[model samples]
Target chain A: MTALAEPIGRGGAERASLARRASGWLVLALVLVSLASLFVGATGLSPFAFLKAMLAGDAVDLRTKVVILDIRLPRLALGLLVGASLAVSGVVMQGLFRNPLADPGLVGVSAGAGLGAIVAIVLGGLLPPALAAAMGYALVPIAAFAGSWLSVIVLYALATRGGQTSVATMLLAGIALAALVGAVSGTLIYMADDAQLRTLTFWSMGSLGGATWGKVAAAAPLMLAGLIAAPFLARGLNALALGEPAARHMGVDVQVLKRVAVVTVAAAVGSAVAVSGGIGFLGIVVPHLLRLSIGPDHRYLLINSALLGAIILTLADMVARVVVAPAELPIGIVMAVIGGPFFLWILMRRRGLMMGL
Target chain B: MLTAETLTVRLGAHEILQAVDFTAHAGEVTAIVGPNGSGKTTLLRALTGDVAFTGAARIGALDVARAKPWELASRRGVLAQFTGVAFPFTVAEIVRLGQASGTAGAATDLTEQALARVGLAGFAPRRYHDLSGGEQQRVQLARVLAQVWEPLDESGPRWLVLDEPVASLDIAHQIEVMELARAFARAGGGVVAVMHDLNLTAMFADAVALMARGRVVTQGPVTAVFRDSTLSDAYGCKLRVNVAPPSSTFILPHAALT
Candidate 1:
């Protein structure tokens, strides 16, 4: 036990406290950004006016009430759900692959879901009239979910041999799968008429403009379920960082972890993409930023990523609303414009550190 | 104690390990030494359940193949030869992963103590990827130490299975790591390490198992296995065992005349 004497005196207490403080800060940012998003739309509803109306209580006008409650609230809710879902799924996928660059979009889940949505839109005529009419608006999201799960299952199978999963193989296979799916989606778009083509294009660009209480209700449960189940994965993912053999030696069920991570990413990203279309970068950006800031302890990174993901996406949605004003820019474009440069910066900084690509 | 009987491993068309019968007892350091591709690593992997194998390998009474990972984890810790972590985890965080299947209690203190034991007390917050190769290897050693901190558990003795634990270390650090393994064995734990340094192996190992061409050529007390002829035949080279001052053993490979 004498060997256990403290050799160096530096405190290990700082990281936990730093993580706690960062979590508090992220939550505060989420709240502030959500409030700003509620008032920053093209409707000319100023934050001051909104605050005054809130303070007045029951004195607010019908137009203000409708804009705040019926429109902005649902959009904010959907944005929060999609943001949290995408970011947490990113953490899971990255940890599972043991690579910072691994993302749901890069791994073909978003593309698969996009293809599924396109199929529903373009090929809906092929379904029985009664069934198509009955499914109606719900068909695309359901199809998208199924497609995402299918792609991930295939990707997981292809990338894994025996009990080991190769991150490089997963990434390369994902790119190939995405290209294959994209080509098929393109063919579907070619067969579509102008209106269907417009829908497909708009969905691919990714917008929160179509947010409604119905969409919010549909996507919320799945996202919440995934988020709630995510923290339980922290310990397993942490062990996995040591490589699979060591992780298994440390008592982590590596197979179970892989299955759970794949399912969680598929469910969460699948639902988000179903509702919000192809919102890119939120997954990769938020987790990488949080890891850089707080270190890669998944116990802290996952929770903080969820909060910061919500805040950043909400703020980005706000920018999409006001930057052009009246006519909305797709939130996906806003995120890419912001996240692309940030990703490049990360790569440049870690060029020497990134081994095995 | 760890025991393997008639263990055979085949990867596709080639046999990696053949009928490898070995045993490492509690309170002893067992060193497995062989030439490159001599199946020393493969044998270690088979013993730790890292690779599928035929025949029997057991940690205490639990079968290596059938035992649950968590069940095995509480009894033994393993240090692999190459641990390539992909993220920028701190030293403390990497070590804390060892506690994943440990009994829930005060782990932070244990983590710090483990680091301190490896001469890395204040390194908790240092980025693991940022550390030098030798430092990173020690951090991994600290992690394994933390997993089975108590050499003797309620269920008899624990074990440390390491694959070339000092391969990346300097001479000073190599001795330090070897001393750590010796200390673990002295404290009633079992140590099974794949070693290449014959001098260090002779200095620390109570028992030596020599493998050549996927088979155990000789295994027993150091005196019996360190004979020059046995070493020469196992390594397929003319080797001289030099008895240094104070009975330390060193193996020297003879070079051909120019």
Candidate 2:
């Protein structure tokens, strides 16, 4: 048995444990990146000074306190949650579709959420004032979450029949859905007043620029639900890598797995998009990079994706803040600028592997 | 034992499998052989509960349709005709998926042993997609083998339901795979394989179920079902079955002895 086992060649247990170890390093990177994010803003806030102020409790000035607590702290928290959400959603979507290229943004989930947000911004005044006040700041995120949830359910229905999902159909339908969403959003944009138009513009082009503790509190529950569901889904998703039937044969409930995966992706991506607009490529780019490194076993892939995604997106948000100084480029633009090339690099390097795609 | 009674499978407007009755006893290799559209694979699918069908299909006491997936999985492992991995997974990783249930007996780590059984020793770390068609098929076989490693346990005998288990392999590997199936059956497990090659089926299958257009033409032992006229009519072509010489180099009458 030992002789036979010797040639087994890196059993999954070892690789999974290796990924577990790798995640510790990723957590460390996330912490370092988060620290860098806190201090790498346009303002002259030094970490040493912040540490000193922390130790000497009453010495920090009001402006400095506001800069760290109200401004940077909320932004960092939102970035971490949103980044983790996007990356984890990407992992789930790709695993659900069994394709590395599948992303929430590509599948119209983000567009649907955008449509819901646009609807809220343009026609919010028409709502009964009391009800609108009741929903409070949560109205947009709720609407966005609903839109994304509906989008996934619709896409799933369109593509699945007899308990089987056709990846090709889901993707083509996603394109059509995105086009339809763009049309609807266009009409709403036309209806927007000047201030509403300004808000719409900022919302459509993604940003953490307006991050508040309230927004973080609103988004965290949905995103956290998705993140929590990911670990449970990891083994099933790994089984699903061998096609739906094979996974079922291996005792995975294929239909339940698909439903849970769809909901997880929708909730996470919807809430993130609701808070931060359309942060493209983070989903696709993060999971793909992690798979290339960690070998696509979702057990560790999902966790490492969360950690690495938080790190990368935090780093990108920091760059977005610092690149244009006090005037900020939307985090979406920064993501596209970096992620677009990285995605192409992946394509160029793995062109042979893309033959199936 | 595995049995399907009045099994019918419909796709869109057509009934792919029409009230097909079949049975395979424990500790025997039962082969399903037929023409291209004769529903051989569909029958296997129905038995495995991959497709919805009306009628009763049961492995042991568990109803295939009503039983939970894990319950069925613990009793049998299925080898699909074509299994594609969506992402890059090592051969070892693919085989380890079979161990996910942890029901294959006291020894949970059958990855290496399973690989060696399928002639895939030392091929574990190789990427599944990087392998040739035949190699991938064997890797999948290894995975299935790991899934139901022991032939019998406290519950009852396990089963291996395979669809076209060796459609792509060269003749040498084909023999290896068929022997693996035979050995599995000989170990008190049951194996129901959909076979394209009649000679291999004759050599390994303890019983044969012949079908024509979703209906069973005849089903019995190899000698009874592999008759010339029966096979010719079922396949819609002339097929002559000749008993090879006892000392023949390639074809042996080993199944006849069984």
Candidate 3:
């Protein structure tokens, strides 16, 4: 009889009504920010001017028109893709690892990707100009994805004991792998000439300067594929959040689900890293925020986190573009400047959640 | 029909359950009882093919060892003690997951009915993470119920496997769930539970199976197995046994050793 007070009144229409209202406000806020991105840049474009430019498909100045379409629009689109990928990846990592403090980058995945890109740059600089010119920017991102996937595979192999993945051992192994990759990165920096060092520094900090339509075009399809595949994974993920054995009992192929999530996260984060560089913590922050907003159902959580992540990244990138007008700061730096404080707040606010980390 | 033949399960160096053999008939509640680490949960998992076992389980001409995931899913609905809910799924949405064929037909309605059976009606639209532990279990129970809830002709052999189902429930809900399991068995479904409470097991179980060190020590009708000597042996200590006037059984662990 005790602890059964009022049956918790399953499906109170009134509570559902409130949740819907909150979601409405969140969506509305995102819309306003997206629209704001069109106008609130260094260019003296008004909301009406930006909207007209978007709809009318023309501008008085050809350069301005090109900037809106070629520069800002693709930048906005890439932001959305990267954001969605990181948020979804973060949520998946949390479930897959069964630790609230867990993030996709926990297993040295992003670090590996970053190191891969840095190495590509080092090797490319050594190559003859004709060969380098043929490859263009493609080699770096491709190398990054390959390295990231390899790191994930190694971590998975290391962390798995018998058939089960131990959450603690995985985390520890991730940390160790990250340190090793990080040391490699540091050595590269030490050996590089000023130009390579500069490139390495910017890439390591993360950036959206490389946000061309080409990169966005590449990222969009993979992001869409991940977003589509993510919601179907909710049932298995929700079951996993309890523990592996419990998930297995509920007819969830626990190991299969883990593999699916790991691969999905790898692909999603790998592509995001390929384009935007090593943007830390957006993956960690957005999923937690979504959990706070909606209850912990992956069906809603996955989609909402994607949207929120896109909206936040766009808004942050907008700030990055304007903060030092003419010489735009990299968006990754902007995110860190904002994200670091918020992360501290979260750990302080949710100590219990951080325990498993 | 469920039969466990000399099942021995080991975890690390600990022999949690050893050579356990028992059979549970359809349309009856079979309760497995013992102290902590006596391997009750392991036996249930072994039966469902969730864990590997040294022996085999035969259910209606099917072997547990070679059964496919879907094959096992169709024959048994299991509720592990700790069900994780890290995502934000509505209660109804969660219950609907038990739909193997992925349709919202009569079976879906039965899921809602099952939730109602566990006093979780109208909670369907609520977020799962916001609910208490007991509420989550009911939602899980509803999910299992929906998985097993089939139409008349397609109603194949199904067994309910619950590991500590009532551990997190309130006293009232505990009785409600016990009564539901009893009713399901009465309606031709099989029920196997790993439970700790001797009193509730006495009230609802048709037969009692005892496990120790990963093996079924003995199993029989409730009246025969739930004796002072059996209780003492089950816990590896001397234990007092009392039969209440209301036909309920009681047990206690005797004092410490040197």
lDDT of each: 0.85, 0.85, 0.75
What is candidate 1's lDDT per residue for A184-246, written digit by digit as tens? 988998899999998888888888887889889988888898898899999889888878898
lDDT by residue (tens digit), candidate 1, B1-258:
799999999999999998989999999999999999999999999988989999999999789999999988988899988899877777887787776555433345677788988889888977777788999999999988888888886788889999999999999999999999999999999999999999899999999999999999999989889988999888888888888888888877777321
**Docking quality category of candidate 3 according to DockQ thresholds:** acceptable
What candidate 2 keeps of the native contacts, as a fraction, is 0.68
The digit string of per-residue lDDT tens for model 3 on A148-199 reads 9899899989989887766678789988999999899788777788888787
Order of candidate numbers by DockQ, starting with the best: 2, 1, 3
lDDT of 2 by residue, A163-195 (tens): 777767888999999899899999989878999
Candidate RMSDs in Å, in order, are 4.7, 4.7, 5.5
- Model 2: what TM-score? 0.92
TM-score for chain B of each model, two decimals: 0.96, 0.93, 0.90
**Model 2 agreement with the true structure over B96-203: per-residue lDDT tens digits:** 888775388435578789999989898887778778999999999998888898988889899999999999999999999999998998889999999988888878
Model 3 RMSD in Å is 5.5
Candidate 3 C-alpha lDDT tens digits along B56-129? 89765568888655566666777878776544456776676665422224422565687898899778777677
Span of ten consecutive residues with least summed lDDT in model 1 chain A: A1-10
DockQ list for all candidates: 0.50, 0.56, 0.33
Docking class of 2: medium
- Write down the TM-score of every candidate: 0.92, 0.92, 0.83
